[model samples]
Target: MGVSPDTAQGLLDELFLISRALRRNLAQPEEGRLLPGGISVLVNLESAGPCRQVDLAAQIGISASAMSRHITELVADGYVLRNTDPDDGRAIRVEVSSTGHELLGRIRESRIQGLQEVMADWTQDDAERARHILHTLRSQLIARDSRNAAADHQKHSEERIDVQ
Candidate 1:
């Protein structure tokens, strides 16, 4: 059954609240803690492996210049390594360094501990159900976004052809 407008709006509100809370909680800067964007870059690099900076920026929905600055800081901090792409000498590929992996592990553990404390009253089943629902919702949204992006690209291509 289709979700009612009220239900949809409620879901959106809850999602926004959750996002804001998480960001606020995580944004507390410590001596070793990364800024949110740097954390995102490290996480993506760790998950997706090495790729060009431009592609990484696109995947993370950031401007290329912003990505460059993040990468520069990460490299300077010894959290990430940048090397020339083997296939394209002019391009650079970034990969998480060993230090980055250690930092990510610590970050994950810290987040998990915080979550456990927050959900101390909840049962394991409740946590599992929340995880499953959130995962499903995220997957569906990503799929829809991919489809829309592809359609937009095709339309742009057709426009270029017509112009020519």
Candidate 2:
């Protein structure tokens, strides 16, 4: 059965509220320490190990130039280290520094504490279910977005050919 209009509206409203709450209430890594999107870069590098700038950009779905800007700021902040790829001297690989790892650990602890405080009233099962549902929703959204982007690109390419 399809969701009713009212149910859909409610879902949208709740999702917006959740987004705002997380953005505003979640403990920030540090005040004026890292540029916007820097945390994502650091975390990804830590998880994925040293990676070329282009690869990191593609993985994060950002332009290489934009990613480079973030990397520059991160490097200046001593959170990331950049070095020439030994296998490909033309490419630069980025890795998280020791300081970056410590910062990430602190951020993780803060977020965990914040989440625990927020979910204090929830049962263990409720917390587990919430995590599962959120992950499933995120995966579905990403897949749908990727499919839409591909279709749009194909449509644009066809339109260009048609015009020619």
Candidate 3:
């Protein structure tokens, strides 16, 4: 069964608020801390291993130029290493450096500590339940977005064929 309109609206509102709050929190600068975008790039690279710049941009939903800038800064900061793509001599692949991994560990620890403080009133079970529900919701949303993007691409391809 579909969710009620009111429930859907509530969920959207909550998500929006959560996103805003997180953005605001991340905006507060800590000494030697990476910006949110840079952190996201590092995290993605760390999890996905080495990837081409364009592929990383697409995966992170950012422009290639923006990804290049992030990579440049990261490389300068010694947080990532850029190497020639073995399979494609002309292309470059980026991977998290040892320093990057160390930074990520620190970042994770800080975030966990912050979350622990925020959730201090909640029981362990409450945190686990919330995590499970949020993870499922995130997976469903990604799958739905992938399906929609595929359908749109197919429609555009058919339209181009009809025109030709």
Best by TM-score: 1
Off by over 4 Å in 2: 4-6, 29-31, 149-164
The deviation in Å at residue 102 for candidate 1 is 1.0
User: What TM-score, computed on C-alpha atoms, does each candidate reach?
Assistant: 0.89, 0.82, 0.87
Against the unseen true structure, what C-alpha lDDT does each candidate score? 0.87, 0.86, 0.86
Superposition-based RMSD of candidate 2 using all C-alpha atoms, in angstroms: 2.6
Task: For residues 1-164, write the lDDT of model 2, one tens digit per residue.
Answer: 78899997998899999877975787484824666777878888788899998898887888989898999999898889999998989878999999889888988888789989998999999989988988997898899989998999999999999999
lDDT of 1 by residue, 1-164 (tens): 79999999999999999987977775434324555578888899899898988999999889999999999989999999999999989888999999989888887877778778889999999999999999999999999999999999999999999999
Q: lDDT winner between 1 and 3, please give it.
A: 1
Worst 10-residue lDDT window for candidate 2 reads 27-36
How would you order the candidates by TM-score, starting with the best? Answer: 1, 3, 2
Show pairs that collide, candidate 1.
Answer: none
Query: Which candidate, 2 or 3, has the higher TM-score?
Result: 3
Instruction: Indicate whether candidate 2 or candidate 3 has the larger lDDT.
Output: 2
